[model samples]
Target: MLYYKQLKVLFLLIILKSCFFAICVAKIGFSTKTPYEFIHPPQKNVIEDDWYNAHTDQYTCGAVHVSAVIRHGARNPGESDSKRIANIHMRIKDNIKDGDKFKLLKDWTNQFPVNNNKNLNDAGENEQHHLGQRTARRLKSLFLEEDMSAVQFMVSSAKRTEDSALAFYEGINEEIPSEAPEEFDSEVNDENLRFHTMCQKYINSVENNSTALKEYKVFGSSDLINQVLEKVIAKLGVEKNVLEPADLKTMFVICGSEMAVFKFSPWCDLFDDEDNEIMQYWSDLKKYYKNGPAYRITWEQSCPLVAELFTIMDDVIAVIERTEEDKDTEGYLLGNMMFGHAETLGPLYAALGLFNDTVPLTSKNYHEQKNRLFRTSEILPFSANIMFVLYECEENEELLNDEEEEDDNPDDDYRIQLFVNEQPMLIPGCKNLLCPYTDVREWYSDISDDCHFEYLCDPHKKMHNEL
Candidate 1:
């Protein structure tokens, strides 16, 4: 009878323990109904260039030459974005209640810093430093062999970009000081690096052209933006009638920037998956209309830089061809690396016909948007880059022409491979990432024809100039 009594007590204790656990969960509000209880970190899809290992076989033809155009690292919110976030915080503090969710929001709001300047924070600097280190490790051979003069490192005059370039250079030199340059080169709004900024016509067209920005308006007004905004505003405990889209957009930008700077911010958790999709689409609209395919001059504005890229590649090839003949020929131009803004990188990608969606992105296709290829976060994220690799290889004999020809020699072929954010980009006519240098050159040659600076930027020219 004593043993039976002890067993009953044990069972009773278990039941009480389960009840207590249920109570804690209920109080914690850890359920879908309480979606905003914890803020999610900003989407990392557009944050930075993720570091990756290059396959050993990737350099088989040898990374004899390489070039890159990259965006700056993570940064603090810009002037406009900063003001919006601050204003929203003030509003929240004034109106917040003493509820469970409100307390969490209040805690995060307290932690969020008030500084609203556009500069590289600690995390941003680290991103650039790590990019340099990764580049050094990947091309250790090239770094060891080439000096600063042989390798080109160029940056825009912006403070963050310059800092990022220096950080990258520091990473390379730290690993192998022998080939590192004592100082990196920076240019102030160089036409090649920042052509759009310098071109008044392009800027005016983007800002004032209603026809060009029709799609931006469509996307911004779609159910996507409205529903998401309504949901986000409610979650933030703000009235939609009280807050406007511009005000809300500032909050959105701040949320992403805060997540990047602080590693995690309550602002990030304001949006769920569907909300994030809407936000992403909204961002894509701005990027597209501002620097992408929204305007006619978008691709043409990037032509000057494309020309520069071609020149860099041709110069490197000239050296390679000479080295092949005389082996002792000075390889003065082995690699070229550039750091620029999204203003430069976005249109440049569009000019190159990369990341283009087969079906034009539109509000009517919101349901099919998921299948579209032109995602801004994927293509124009911080520290994003596109690399062109020039290589020489012994051609495959069996895969070669059956008819003997003097230039058909398998051993004399040169190859090129292109990578965007460390992933291979497939050219329309090229075989995989690796394609014949001649074919790649021809493709770029065609691009260069359409991207003439004088034709696109010259207001005096009889082209698409309304101003």
Candidate 2:
């Protein structure tokens, strides 16, 4: 009878434990907590160029130019986001009547000032500096010198972007000191980097339109909100409550922000993986409608940058063909570094035909689209970069006698490799990992022939809201 009584008590304890909501990991998506470790490329390392020689022994190659477009590193939440987060946290603290296990939340104080949000935090600076150090080491061949003269660096006018570029440049400076004759401008307002803000159609039709975000809003207000609410109540052990879906979003945002800065947070303990996914979907849907493939003009504005890329590539051919005297020409260039925002990457991805979902992401199909490609965390995470490494190659025999033979082929093949967040990514029309320059050019020819930004962003063009 004593054993039976003990067994019943044990079963009762097990039932109570099952009823408790266990905490899971916190995943903040593209907002912060970049997939790239900020200290390491979370993917396998592909930094060295030596392995390619084994695959393509017929041709000897070296990287002559590298063009990288990168997003800024982790930053503080925006002023509005910051304010909302503080407000929500305060309300939760106030409503804790009894049985609440929110010791950390109760003790946690909002030290981050409301008005000073969205600037680069110390952690953000560290991320950029580390990335720059890695970049200098990765492109050691191109970064062989302490000169920035051969480099072209550009950034959007945002203080955060400029801060990130400076941080990256400082990282490069550590490896190879900067002694360039001239410094690149911080305020070029280059449409290539700041295309979204410059385009009238994108600004008017998408950025300003609340109705365009209807699908995302529907998802935000869907059953997931209740799911998140239930989780928060169970985990917080709250007896009294005053929370809404918007407050939950603010909660998630703070969870991400705190993680980015402090590397951990108690707020994350309130969520399960599925709860986090719902929050991520809410943000992804917004990107899809506003900057992604939803509208035609949005991605087409990338024509300017595309035209510039191919032109620079064509200049590569001209570079090899020209005499040594032309090396000192006024406009001779070797590399370009542009730092922009998530707004920048989304449209560019759309232009390149990357990360497309077969069917649009909506409130109803969240579970079905679990494996969809438009995940911003994977593609547009903080400090994410798209690397365009341009290689000049020649037949092994031709390379052996290049200085002696003036009759070398001017039509020498140039190879191109694309890397996303430092992992090898193939250009859409390329045959393999390393693609011929001409072939890649042919694939994006529409950049020159079809897309003209002025025409694409016609202010008077009627906007379509349907996916």
Candidate 3:
């Protein structure tokens, strides 16, 4: 009887081991597949009707400054498993009020598969590339025939952002010199320094909290808590980690010379205002940490949690219209490159007021052009707008000449026009010329259900003739 009992126990252990291995393999295999579905339709060509006779009507002989903001192009979807993991965790936490039960299940289930794809794929890359090219081409067509090398260029630090900038610049193919200096390598080094400083700050806070440290031990997993504790202890032991603080500091300076400086100014207020709400949810998640640090949730578990809150924060930020004061301040650039999953785009667009709003396009709208031209392809289920902003100095009346001088070329005039859905509309001019059209109404007499519009010489006349 004793021998048979021992055999049964061995058999049970083997079964458990096999099950654990299978789960691990399944999770690993599931994560490799694309998380989001890619949807591609037929590409449309730029219609000839989109080009209006701006030279005859609204062409201003003076220089004008323009700015634009646009959405990034389409991108690949997120990991399927991570989404699954987040959904399961959130669902369990929401439905099961019992703390002990939650912890018990969470600890056991945390190893399961969750969301999946983590970066942009081929379609996303192409979207950004094409969008940038189209935007650049359109800008060149509106501006003078001179090389665009003199234009000041700023881009976000994301992969897609950088790619978009490169593609756009290539498309323009003008010999214009870059207004900004090239410092890609140095800028990357500075970002690394900034990240290290943030990490040090977090470590310092952890060391100062004796009660929290104890709680961290009880609630947090041994693996993560111990790793953090080890790093803190090592920092206290030796000054070796202290590099040439001066040299390091110099390397880390966020300067204008850097190709990518992520200034959180415009969006900082949005994030700051929601700190309380974010912390509240974070605090709630702490209750489950009886087995691990709340903030230390794995990427798989954190993606959904972060995504949902981020979406809400985006909505809150979108309502904040830029004040006159904001307009006066120097602008913020999103970055030249963006990596990670595509879901990051939704909240970004929501914050920028790109969708679900009925703000009619007008002359004043062009003033906010810089914000309107920002674009990316990392976010799925959305199309990106390729907008451009051209800035020029105020005109000197003394330079004005009534007759076309022998040297003046009529084909090389400076005018800002927009091509929307194959319909051309002139943007509001500066102090030099009177804007002939007020809204889209003057261009398209018959209001069609389709968002597309066509140019009309005189809408009132067209209606009168029809009558």
Instruction: Point out the higher-scoring one by lDDT: 2 or 3.
Output: 2
Stretches > 4 Å off in candidate 3? 1-66, 80-117, 141-148, 174-383, 386-467
Relative to the unseen true structure, what is the C-alpha lDDT of residue 17 in candidate 2, on a scale of 0 to 100? 48
Clashes of 1: 2
- lDDT score of model 1? 0.63
Off by over 4 Å in 2: 1-58, 98-100, 178-187, 238-241, 324-331, 397-412, 448-451, 462-466
The 10 consecutive residues of candidate 3 with the worst lDDT sum are 26-35
| Ranking of all predicted structures according to TM-score, beginning with the best and ending with the worst | 2, 1, 3
* Superior by TM-score: candidate 1 or candidate 3: 1
Q: What's the ranking of the predictions by lDDT, best on top?
A: 2, 1, 3
Residue 361 local lDDT, model 2: 83
- With a 3 Å backbone cut-off (N, CA, C), the pairs that clash in candidate 1 are 39-269, 40-269
Which digits, one per residue and each the tens of the lDDT, describe model 1 over residues 1-467?
23323444553453365357445221111111111102222232422212222222222356567788877777776666665666777777666553467564564443333454467666667767766666666667665756766667777767877887778778777766863255666555467677877776676677556766677678777776777778767876666565655654666676666545443445656766556666667667667767776555776787777877777777776777677689888665666778887888888888777776767666567678775566766676667778887676654445446684335543235677787776678876776677777777787786664566665676665435221
- Per-residue lDDT for 67-162 in model 2, tens only? 878888888778898778778777777777553466767767765667773777776787778777777767776666537766777787788888
**Clashes in candidate 2: how many?**
0
Report, for every candidate in turn, its global Cα lDDT versus the true structure.
0.63, 0.71, 0.28
Error of 1 at 313 (Å): 1.5
lDDT of 2 at 360: 86
